[model samples]
Target: MKKRLTWAAAIAAAALSGCALAPGPSLDSKRMHDDLGAPTDTTVYDVKLITPQLIYALKQADEADAATKQASLSTQALPAESADYRVGPDDVLGIYVYDHPELTRGASGNAGNDMSPLVDIGTLQASGGLGGVLPQQISALGTNGQGEVDTSGQRVAANGTIFFPTLGRVHVDGMSTQQIAALLTRRLGSQIKNPQVDVRVMQFRSQRIQVTGDVKNPGQLSLTGSALRVVDAINRAGGGNPDADLQRVLVTRGNRVMTIDVNNILNRGDLRQNIALQSGDIVHVPDHTQNRVFVFGEVPKPQTVFMNQGRLSLADALAAAGSIDTMNANPRQVLVIRHPNPPLAQLDGTQGTVQEGLKKVSYAPEYNKPEVLRLDMTQVDSMMLATQFDMKPLDVVYVGTAPVSRFNRVLTEIMPTAQSMFMLWSIARNR
Candidate 1:
């Protein structure tokens, strides 16, 4: 036992002596970030000097935030009359002729040239439920002044005209139900006694919109009316796909194109982009490509933070990633890596090709070019710097750790092994 004790003491003494002789921890945060600033192929910009740009960006952001709030505050609904869905081709309409019961028969029975009793839509539906007779299918049973039995209800032709009994071919292409009824009433007043007509649109089949790209179901949709908003159309297409970029939905109508940030509408209650959709419009939700900023290094979460309202700043990115690890991180050594803006090429008399232009722009700098910015919060206010520095997509925010903190972390990891060795040495010496 005594021999074993002597060997253990010798081993413990040698281990302690080796640790004492070893070089001290040299993980200086400022020195480590020195290479981060003004390094090879990197252009360093001091945050203090760019106060003018920061002020402009922050002012714009504040104005935009206020505008978003103002939009949400407005409670006035869109004018109902302004959204009057104009009647179009393929629409099913229910026509009613006052005082003439025989003129209002369903499409089922043939237009009997005789004066037959008119069975109203309510009576027909009540007899055998909805399957009995639909209101929109109701048509005049008796013949017109020309003695022709028009059994088929009015179907707006491809040429935007509908064949009527006495009225012959009526052009109802952009006309409303009320306008059609008034026209029929005025024409039929001369033929019949005190003629009055009523028209109501039953089925809206004309306005078909196509929703594609990042939608659960990408296909054409028949809009019920002009009331179909952008949000409603997206929902009708089975909502957005899992990887859909809600912030950058493109809506195209011929030459006019607009991008809608649905995240602002859904999350921040901004409804300015929730505009009314038109016929032949295309709504496309694209895949989430460049919608996140990376905050790594000494942050608590060190995660890729997604943006709202399609805009993000350093302050928002840091807050989203749970801020920097204050216990072990140096707030003074914050670095943001960004892409450098390429200068415009000298335009010649001739138009240049896209590839040639790209090549010319490539001469400016690569995307990974170290356009690094060091944010020294120790000298200036931390909040001020964070708010001023606008973080673009794919920008990397890294917070480095202090040298003393790094040394402390190293010692914490080695302390357990050192303590065990010390205990063994104490036991051996006592023995």
Candidate 2:
């Protein structure tokens, strides 16, 4: 009876020890319970049943949306294209006469005295004594120091009012080159038979656009004519650096400011957001400090991923971090923590449902819908499925221990005792 009781006690102790030796739930599971309370299986599918913190984040995102709408409304009152652009003080103009050579003399007269019928009329490159002539002629005009040249080799006064031998002081400010040329032709018609005048920009010194931040090179870029688009300016700056946040490009012209998504143009091929640039405009490329997502847990290489273009999905993010640990990974518990903003919130909220709906709606795995994702790394066949899971920034992919790992640990602990007991029982039976 005593032997029976001892054996029973031994068995109970062994069973109790075995239970203790078994692996507990993962650290992430424990943390989830502690930080977010117990996660119910039902709540996993329903966003409404999520934690209050998540709901608060969602509300904050909604508030941001409202603010964005209000700001957009304010800009709606402003003209789509600015009309305040006037020929400002000290602004340079490029003058060209096309086929008419005599009317296209340089204001500085540095083109040499050969008096050729046709001039290349290149941009003004004043050197040595030639630079003084143009500025001096411009100062003589009664108007501001802005200068002009007429067909008769006459330099206009500072006020852009040049008195030709026939036509006296005509105001050329606030007028297009074509308009000014036509006016000159009309003025000179009576003096000279069938006079022709031509004008083109020579220098773009006054028409400047400031490009600052996150570019390979950042500084003031020249805008010659109306051809200097936003992309042209960025290209002039040597394009965005590796870490540039192409999503938010700010353009401020006077009191008006516009935010353009350059990434949309590059990535999605959306040309609508490509806006035309204007003079005295500031193109600020802010540092891409915010659009980063951290990948942790059981990924092979955990890191903070920089998002260059539009929204980054979950699977893309995971692949970027060298993929999850397939050897000891659990795909079902992949956690994606996104911004509380509406677009991201909406994306994350619909993820599970979309994935599930795909499997239900589409018979083929490849035809699966967007957002519904499952991670099963058990077989090599599931590799494609793993690849299909989209990843968002700041997403956490945890690959827990394989079942074999847990079983090995438990079996190793029990094997020594089991072997010793078998040996002792054999010795007693032999005796």
Candidate 3:
């Protein structure tokens, strides 16, 4: 019996040697691993101890970053009045000459059907600059006093040139309306005395921009007359949805991609963020579904916390997870894991080639290493520090287990195995 008791004692000691392995779910401190590795002072992941001063500095840095971005974007944004739009293929032109009623195509009021060898008002107007940003009003603006320039003008040929009576087929492609009128006047001067020629865009069919995601009405907007600014197009699209994340709006223009914070334009009334949109630009407003933080371990309820308006304090996230379990949780130790977002780099789709003959640039995203942070919740100022600490997306807050509780669990698990071994030893001795 004495030898059996000694054997049991040895088994218990062996079980205690393996006690380092966790008997249950537990989050370990990285400090132990840091000391075990390569005699280096630095741990694998960044471990920031939560403090009041650190939280304040982070807040200051965030404010400075936002201000710098705002200033930089404002300088690069287009002016309020962008350059006049040039005529393009599929565009419609309305030509009006003062005191030249006989020369105008539909000026004779043949219901614009009879094509004058010179001006065909019948073929014109039925087509056409977007007529200001409000293309719906194109029907009200007429060069021949007809209903709409779109319905009354001559649509530009696919070759980007328009044909008129005296000018024959003068090149109007890529030329602004003012430039077109001046060129026509110079050419028509040979046929008439100082012809007062006026050219206005009746229809703008060449350039279109798409607005999608989180908007009330996601669709295309025409770039007619003047260039459409970002804000103007969004307003035209019926604003954004309730869960729209305006702070991270993405605008993809061909090979270039830009992140615009629409909140500056809507909340702070900063119009500089409203950059001029180009044809083929795709504006996307993402929602708040991606803005979330996870809380787990030693908590009453482990769940995800959704950030409101792109902001969530660490304290709030912990509270939503039901704080910490007082029974077996160690208030002295808490952990936070944060992974940085990969750089945003998306170019022209699957074509992979930015443009023909140009080498395809690789936009392979570089993922950053995640950071692990420690907090001593038992400290008096810890609550205050947590309140000021802003939580980012994909952050994980973990409450560590009490050391005594962990040791007890280890003993509890091993004791049953130890008891089973002792029972088998007793049966062997009897045999």
For model 2, residues 1-431, the per-residue Cα lDDT tens digits are 56655665575567668855678773545445454566654523321212334435745764575456435634552346643333433444334333333344443332221122222223323331232224333323222223444323433346765444345567766666677778778876776676646554444344578899899889987654455667778988999887787776777777656667687677767565566677778888877676776777667888878764646545567778887777655654455543322222233222332211002121332222222223444445455544433334334444455577668879999998798667655544454
What lDDT, from 0 to 1, does candidate 2 have? Answer: 0.54
Q: What order do you get sorting by TM-score, best first?
A: 3, 1, 2
The collision pairs in model 1 are: 103-140
Better of 1 and 3 by lDDT: 3
For each candidate, give its TM-score against the true structure. Answer: 0.56, 0.51, 0.69
lDDT of 1 by residue, 1-431 (tens): 87877789687788788875679775647655455555484555544333546558757975675565335423322233344567788865556675563553222332232223223435765564233234443333333534443344566778898776677888888987789889888888888977767665555677778999988988987766447778888998899977788876777766545567688788877776687777898999887666678898888898888765467888899888888887878877788876543212222324443222112223322343445667766765667867767776567788889899999999999999989878887777766
183 Cα displacement, candidate 1 (Å): 1.6
Model 1 whole-model lDDT (C-alpha atoms): 0.66
Off by over 4 Å in 3: 1-43, 67-81, 102-151, 340-367, 419-431
Off by over 4 Å in 1: 1-59, 62-81, 101-152, 295-305, 308-333, 337-374, 377-392, 398-431
Candidate 3 matches the true fold with a TM-score of 0.69
Worst 10 residues of 1 by lDDT: 353-362
Better of 1 and 2 by lDDT: 1
List all candidate RMSDs to the true structure.
Answer: 12.5, 13.3, 9.7
Which candidate wins on TM-score? Answer: 3
Give the per-residue Cα lDDT of candidate 1 at 155: 62
TM-score of 1: 0.56
Q: Which candidate number has the best lDDT?
A: 3
